[model samples]
Target: TTCWFAPGSGSSRGQGPPQQFNQVQTTYFTSIEILSDLYKKKVLIDDYLVDAYIDTGSKVNIISYEAAQNVTSSMEPSNVIMRGFGGLHAQSLGKVAFKLFIDDLHINSCAEITTKSNLGSIDLIIGQPTINHPDISLVTTSKSVTLLKNNISDNFLTEMQLSSTDFISKVTLFLSDDVELSPGAQCEVDVYTDHELDTSHVIVTQPKIFSLGNVSYFIPQAVLTKTPYRLQVVNLGVHSINWSANKLIIRAEVFACRYVLSVNI
Candidate 1:
């Protein structure tokens, strides 16, 4: 019953997967373009190797039902339901405690048995709860991945409660020169923090309009309150295009409103 969506992105809604043995959960998810590498890690589920995807957007870890069959742990009923592409809903089979290895990193995690019939060629989708272990810090850049066993930071020493998610707005994309995309051109979209670091991917299917829905961001109140300063801003008021590594790059700086990005050719 397990299936993979558009690489990185999954829908945030659910229709509901039903209960009963051999019954499939019709979890719906949309295609989300994600940055991927061969960083596939393997672990045994009843002796079968499950290559896991380290998906950050996923709030929970999911393992295919077949994988669960190989493990010895009993399933703990899960109330979690998921939404897939085209908005199909699927229910989870429950959860089981499992252990795996990411290189030398010993990962002990609980994985939900999903109704996803299969994960294509791979087997597991590792989500946040499994990767958010307090003792370790994981950082993956364009070239390298660094995992810290223990570290502390005072930048965010205090947790700020968010009042709402209205900081960002959704927008579409278009060429400044108005060039049409060739049939189905594949592209990846990454959203960075204000500093252009700490990247996250949003799935953009339609080439002409890479729409990121109302994605709001939160900034610590203290940083803005005590040390008020203007940050060096890029993409503020520029409509330009360039070629980078054979891929067409469109750059636009937009104000906080819904408008089509005019990437100049």
Candidate 2:
């Protein structure tokens, strides 16, 4: 997702374009489950089990006040600032470290975050640091996710072996010599792979293009609303190849359309 935030009043605003400001982009992972083993007891919370959003944008895993209290009874009262669609809000804080399990992969000593009930039914927001494992791929779709782990690595080769099932899809990788774009606009490059697959494991090496014919793709929105930008496609599956250049911008506009119509009505 790409987000455009208006610049605050400052001399820094003069450093860039006048109308647009900074652009924040994040690769979102969702429909994930986090299982915890407190002592000898196991606790499983699926994305459906407890409201959760896998946010690469967040740096730490945040658990709701009610959920945090339920998990750890020794939470202390503290103040923290939480940012969201409605802007910044003050939230109470606490800490806890629990074993986290995403899909079949498990990690111990994961960071725990605490927040107020204002985050709604979400039990927690899983951040990047906890889920940024090297062996696994976090595929984000319009509604779901598929976690793919490469068992051929030295760490997992002993525990498991690579199989045909690991090839979830035949992805065609592409690299642009120089990515061109309009100022304050974003673009999306679509590459058609060999088969329709569910996992997001398209790896790009140096000179990342399979074939040059009709391989160069473009979309018409500025990803960062600024002149210079870098694009990295991670954890992409074949079925979800049609990447959006300004997903956040589109989402925001769509969300506000109803409100604008209501006001006009």
Candidate 3:
């Protein structure tokens, strides 16, 4: 809320006054309906509508410490740390199982609990973990977004040629059932690409460790071109999984799913 530029702290030094820059702290939020996912049925979380902030820059989903307390489950002790853009880690109350409906969709996962009052009036902060929904689209020009299922023919299409930076393929892993991440627990995998898509050289990303829930999807995001593209996901987890169908399907913070990468043909 403060907008004034101060000269470099020590102009006396030869560094001279650094370029003046405006520092602005802003927040983006959206309205959403909240519900609890349960056995064969769903219930509203607070018997009221909830407004959630859509933050594309965040890696993990966050629920205010106070909000998490309102849920029916008990908070499990977790060592997961929340880190901001500057790498400053924030303290958390702990992690809790959260099942809720937002934007007319269902979300069942464990959300880290934060008691910080800085989230403004919103109880939930939708982060990147959910924002990558395959069907979601954000139009800043109109301040609007699109989500969920839609026909590719329903919209304009642009064929994408192979590019070094374009991810031709994607990979994911899922626990058979809801499993909690243990302290110091992590997963990793190596990604490989082939010529089935017709690229001369194989583009392989380094072994990436998984860190989706907290400060970590440490998994290496392998890049690639084809449907169910020819690739291999070497499972590194003895007890966990390694490869999954990589699609643009992600949960959105439009108030977000999985890591979704799309190629237009």
Candidate 4:
């Protein structure tokens, strides 16, 4: 709530008064709805697990001085001032570099260091500098974001392109009966759900590593929501799978069109 500019810190440009130069942007929403709607993830900054907010609108990355201290004791001197909503301002201690780990992928990124009070509950704010990195690709659905290490292969890019085409939402799906599948064999299994559908067109995301050891399924097909909801499940393991009813917990993604078409008769 306090705002103070560094005294005798401005530098002269020409035949004019000393002007402040370095500055960075930050956004802190006062509304609970807006704050809750932002995409949040648990990431590792160096060795510390941090609850981070992903803000695509921001141009710079930010971290609290307390967090930076735990990660590293060194900081490059900076005159950068963080400006946010309601004319709130905080003078930066300095900038620090840290390794940001998202699952198996990690990126070396630099962020402006400020007081913990200035950051509130957020330990880190990942901005466009890291999100827009050449090796990083962020694919966002209706309620989630997929962070991919883009330098690996073209297949990841293709998958991202497909997922980005639809507004996807997840729902728990229940299997109707026990099923068995041989190695590399696939079939459409009927599923049960509690969600009342607003749209018939749904794209089911393939289930990741299931609890069943060495068993995997692929069901990336578009299906209509009917009485007996079915999804094509493939067994990608070396051995056959005799999955029991209600034993395998799978998530189904329902796609809704962002636009509605109307025609005049």
**Candidate numbers sorted by TM-score from highest down:** 4, 1, 2, 3
lDDT of 3 by residue, 42-129 (tens): 2234442455655555555667766776777887654444444132334445566766665455556556666545444566766555
Worst 10 residues of 2 by lDDT: 248-257
Task: Tell me which of candidates 2 and 4 scores higher on lDDT.
Answer: 4
Q: Per-residue CA lDDT of candidate 2, range 1-265, in tens?
A: 2122232222221111122222432212222222322101122332113455565555556666555544433544222233442443323243555555555655553334434444554566666665576766665455556454755334444777665536432233333233333423344433332333323322222222222333332222212211122344332222223324333211101111222333321
Q: For candidate 2, give the lDDT of residue 223.
A: 22
Candidate order by decreasing lDDT? 4, 1, 3, 2
C-alpha lDDT (0 to 100) for residue 219 of candidate 2: 29
Per-residue lDDT of 3 in model 1: 34
RMSD of each: 19.0, 22.1, 25.0, 18.1
lDDT of 4 at 216: 66
Clash list (residue pairs), candidate 4: none
Write one digit per residue (lDDT tens) for candidate 1, span 115-137: 44535545677776766788666
How much lDDT does each candidate structure score? Answer: 0.45, 0.38, 0.41, 0.64
Identify the candidate with maximal lDDT: 4
Local error of candidate 2 at 102, Å?
2.8
> In candidate 4, what are the lDDT values of residues 213-255, reduced to their tens digit?
6766565544444557777777777888887887544775665
Model 4, residue 56: distance off in Å is 0.6
Q: Give TM-scores for every candidate, taking all chains together and pairing residue i with residue i.
A: 0.43, 0.36, 0.36, 0.49
* Native-structure RMSD, model 3: 25.0
The lDDT of model 4 is 0.64
